[model samples]
Target: MTAQKKCPVCGKPAEIEFRPFCSKRCADVDLGRWFNESYVVPEPIDPETVIADDGEGDETIH
Candidate 1:
C-alpha cells in the first residue's frame, strides 16, 4: 500500500513531480505570494491596553 500526501497549498493530493505541491502552477503561485508577503498568518491584537516592555523604556543610569 502507498501512503498519500496532501498538497501544501490547496490540501489536495500531491503530485509526484511536485512532491509537496499538487502542481507546478500551485507551487509557483505560493512562491510568488510568499515573495510578495501577501500570504500571512492572521494574528489577533488588542488595541485597548498597551504593554510597557517593548524595549522603549526610559532607563536612568547612575
Candidate 2:
C-alpha cells in the first residue's frame, strides 16, 4: 500500500482534484504566496555570471 501525501497548507489529506493541495482554497493560498512574492529561491548570482540586458531598461543589480 502507498501512503497519501498531506496538503502543504493545512496538513489535510490531499484531494485528487487538488493533488498536492486539499482544495481550491489551499491551492489558491499556495498560488497567492507566489503572486505576492512570498516564495523565493535565494540563489546568489555572481555579477560576472549575469548577462547584460539588451533592451532599454534601467541597470539592474545582480
Candidate 3:
C-alpha cells in the first residue's frame, strides 16, 4: 500500500477530486504559481545528447 500525503497548501487531507491538492482553488493556485514561475521541476538534459525529432519537429526518444 502507498502512503497518503496531506495537502501542503492548506494542511487539509487530500481528496481525489483535487489529487495532491485539497480543492480546485488550491489546484488552480498551484497551476497559476507554476505559470508564474513559482514552481519549477528540475529535469536534467544532456547538452551533448540530441533529442530525436519527428517529422513535425516534435522531439521524442525512440
Q: Pick the candidate with the highest TM-score.
A: 2
lDDT of 2 at 12: 98
Give the per-residue lDDT of model 1 (tens digit) for 1-62.
65779988898999989978999988997899887785564555656444545766677853
Tens digit of per-residue lDDT, candidate 3, span 1-62: 65666776787877777889888888888788778784565565766565544457635655
Q: What's the TM-score of every candidate structure?
A: 0.52, 0.56, 0.50
Each model's Cα RMSD = 6.9, 8.9, 11.4
- lDDT scores in order: 0.79, 0.85, 0.73
Q: After superposing candidate 2, which stretches have Cα over 4 Å from the reference? A: 38-62
* Model 3 CA lDDT for position 24: 86
Off by over 4 Å in 3: 38-62
Report the Cα lDDT for residue 56, model 1.
67
- The residue-by-residue lDDT of candidate 2 on 1-62, one tens digit each, is 55789999999999888989999999999999887775565777878668665777775755
The pairs that clash in candidate 1 are none
Residue 62, model 2: lDDT of 50
